[model samples]
Target: MRFLLIVFMGGGLGSIARYLVNKWVGGTLTSVYPYGTFLVNIIGCFLIGFLIFFTQRAGASTIFWRLFLVTGFCGGFTTFSSFTFENVELIGNQQLLLFFVYATGSVVLGLLATYLGILAARNI
Candidate 1:
């Protein structure tokens, strides 16, 4: 029950953050389709990788923080849930090409975006 609560809280935070990013970025990003989503995914990816190393070095989060940051925050922030749902709809409609485009585009652009985010953060 406690674990569940942790995840729920974290997810809520993640989801809200994701929403804010989307709202801010909107269609005006003017670089890359779904640039906001791409940006979020990239940021999420960078954090995940960084967390991997940091957690390993000084021990990881307590169960609660893990659930909050990893499950909730990262989960909410990225919106792969929505991404999956949309992808499923595309696939169901037999829009295989679009599905592939969405999938590959999401991955490639997402990765680049994340790397950029990490690079910027590191430099800063």
Candidate 2:
């Protein structure tokens, strides 16, 4: 239906954007971590937060926009698979403390960001 088409378009563009970020940060410019994924997730989080606030305060966000930006773009941008793989790689490499930090920080921070976004939206 129309909803599916909107999400599909948004997800396709989001994936393309992710590819560009990956290429930009791949191997040459950044090292020691998956900088591209990190950048995308962080940017996506902030954007989701901002959008939530905007959607709440303005009261003008349509279903199509929500499907596109949130269900599609944010969904496509954040990578649970990459996060899990990184954690496993860290653990396999005997970086226990590093793995702990990454895993804990990712979950905790991501949850906190979502909570804060909701709170901001409600208050504003």
Candidate 3:
């Protein structure tokens, strides 16, 4: 029950952060590429990687923190559904090249970002 409350709080904060980022990035960008979701996904992946690495290296043994940050926060921060819907819309609009680029870029870059984050945390 206590763990659930912590996760709930972390999720709420993560959701607000995501919404703000979307408003800031999405509102400013004039492209149909869904930059907001792309950025959020990559950032969330990076954060998860960093947190995992850092916690393990630092010997932080707390399920509450893990659940709060990884399962709750990062889960809420990233939007796979939005990314897929944007891709579908792009394809429907016949923007094949952009769709391909966006889809591939998100996956490749997201993974890279996570790896980089893990490396960074380990090195630090």
Candidate 4:
């Protein structure tokens, strides 16, 4: 019950943060690109990687933090479904070039961000 509550709280916070980021990015960029989802996914990936490494290196029981931050928060924050849907829409609208760029860039950048996060955690 305690664990569930912790995850629930973290997820709620993450969802709210995601919503705010989407609103801000959408308002700033008037384009067909899914910048909001891309940003959140990459950020979430980095955060998960960082937290995982930091917690592991600390040599402590971080099950609660992992569940809250990684499983709950990051899970709520990242929008894989939206990303896929946007890609489909792009394809249906014949935006193949944009679709490919967005998809490829998100994947490549997300991986890079995760790696950077791991490095950052290790250094800290």
Give the clash total for candidate 2: 0
Write the residue-wise lDDT of candidate 3 on 19-106 in tens digits.
9999999779979798887888878867876765666676657676877886678767875634665687799899999999999999
- Root mean square deviation (Cα) for candidate 2: 15.9
lDDT (tens digit, per residue) of candidate 1 on 1-124: 8888887888888888888888889855765588788878878776655544465565644556656776677777775654665677799899999999999999999999999999999998
> What Cα-based lDDT does every candidate model obtain?
0.76, 0.77, 0.80, 0.82
Q: TM-score of each candidate?
A: 0.56, 0.58, 0.59, 0.61
Candidate 4 backbone clash number: 0
Leading candidate by TM-score: 4
Highest lDDT: give the candidate number: 4
Q: Local error of candidate 2 at 103, Å?
A: 9.3
The local distance difference test score of model 3 is: 0.80
State the TM-score for model 3.
0.59
Candidate 4 lDDT by residue in tens digits, 60-121: 68888877886678767875634655687799899999999999999999999999999999
Q: Write the per-residue lDDT of candidate 2 for residues 6-84, one digit (tens) a residue.
A: 8888788888888888898895575778888888887776766665456667665476687787667766776553465
Candidate 1 Cα errors over 4 Å, as ranges? 27-32, 79-124
Clashing pairs in 3: none
Which stretches of model 2 miss by more than 4 angstroms?
27-30, 79-124
lDDT, candidate 1, at 88: 70
Listed per model in order, the count of residue pairs whose N, CA or C atoms clash below 3 Å is 5, 0, 0, 0
Better of 2 and 4 by TM-score: 4
Better candidate by TM-score, 2 or 3: 3
